[model samples]
Target: MGSSLLPEEFEQAALGLKSGETRRFEISLPADHPDAQLAGKAIQYILTLKKVEQPRYPDIDADFAVSLGIDGGDLERMRAEIKENLERETQRCIRLLLQRQVMDCLLECAALDAPRTLVEQDQRRLAEIARQNMEKQGARNHNAPISAEMFKERAERRIKLGLICAELIQQHDLQAQPEQVRAAVETLSKSYQAPQEIVRWYYADTQRLAEVEAEVAERNIIDFVLSKAKVEQQPMSFEALAKASQSLFTICDKRPEAKEGPPER
Candidate 1:
């Protein structure tokens, strides 16, 4: 992004430069950069402008619809499909928002010491997940050094939440029942074309069945929390809801590291 300065600085330097220009520069990254391996490190960079071009957009015609993979190149049909997809995405995001609020409420109500063993286990798990995601994205250095400290805060939070959920589940007898699990499975299958077939597929595998049961139990916990907590509902436009959910998701994905050592219990 830059030759002799930061990425933003390099962007500024690139302005007015003709194509095929080359520049060499060095810059130091911030300590809080998401990639711990390169954080606070000064590195040399060589930038070459291979090409510059204006953006091109397809015309809003049948060809555009066909490019979107809509059969028959029906523009109206494409719009309808896009609308349906957006509606589903909005609904899913709204549910995630509600679940996040419930979890926040639960964490506020109870604080416990996160076991070191559990924290380490979850830290490794999160790190592995991040690595796999990078690999899936075709990252050049998928196995690049990643500081474990990056996941410590998130791992501890997860451990604490797990402990709290386990205690509440036991005390309130919130174990997922057979009927409830079946209902959960049915609800999940509704999104599929062959709902009954999906339901049967889940029931056919113990592991799949157990995953739904776990979700049912967690949903019960969220419901229980919402029941006890003082809840205020605010109507949000689809745009606002989507923005808020995306912000929350970004925070979760970053998993900022703790600035200080773990507090004493």
Candidate 2:
């Protein structure tokens, strides 16, 4: 059995451990340490648990149906719906995965250092978003606030990804058509009781219409990317795919006063 050790004790234990034996230690860096770059100038983390168990899922059948508040017959219908949804979700996931791979390839092929100022600007934007989200959720900080240096790193990565994606979109000449936008709107309407009313609401606002159009453009780009790349299809139950896709692609209702710009990711 393993014994728990405090940071100071762990450091001592590490000194005596055999070459092949596992060991751990905890250490603190001063705020003025050479490596310190952020405003707060210090960070800390606790590490433990060398191994963890993975949970196994039980079989999905009649029992699962009852648990989900439906009879077996109704469950069959629900399963079908879920499968359809999952298929859509998997496709989207696969598309995102492919995009990341493509971006990585491009970044490697053409290595370049971006301007630090631009990166910092993007970092500030992201930090503002994070701050807003934390405030909205009413979370209390038991530790120091987020730092500019930390956010700058995150912002740089986002800027890099955005530039790569933009280049790819332009290079491929991918554009969303009016018909595609109409079809997307029609598909969105099916979920509402009054499909026409939903359609009207979407069309009545120019911003909302533009948001839908952007979505259509994104879908078009995904389709184009998939066509260029190799895809391996694995057989998934329709119920699983439908549920997954619905969760992936489900659009939220626009606030009455919300002025839409490009569709959100």
User: What's the count of clashing pairs in each model shown?
Assistant: 2, 19
User: Highest TM-score among the candidates is held by which one?
Assistant: 1
> What global local distance difference test value does model 1 have?
0.72
Task: List model 1 lDDT by residue over 45-117, tens digit each.
Answer: 8878888877788798999998877778998988887887788788778766877777666677675688899
Q: What is the TM-score of each candidate against the true structure?
A: 0.63, 0.53
Residue lDDT tens for model 2, 1-265: 1322233545565554544566544355544232223334433443454444457886777777666554563667668757765665566565545444544455576566657877788666655555655666687862335555656544555566556556656888666678888888877675444678878888888878988776666555556756777767677664444443442211111111224432321
**CA lDDT of 222 in candidate 1?**
74
Count backbone overlaps in model 2: 19
User: Distance (Å) between predicted and true CA of 32, model 1?
Assistant: 11
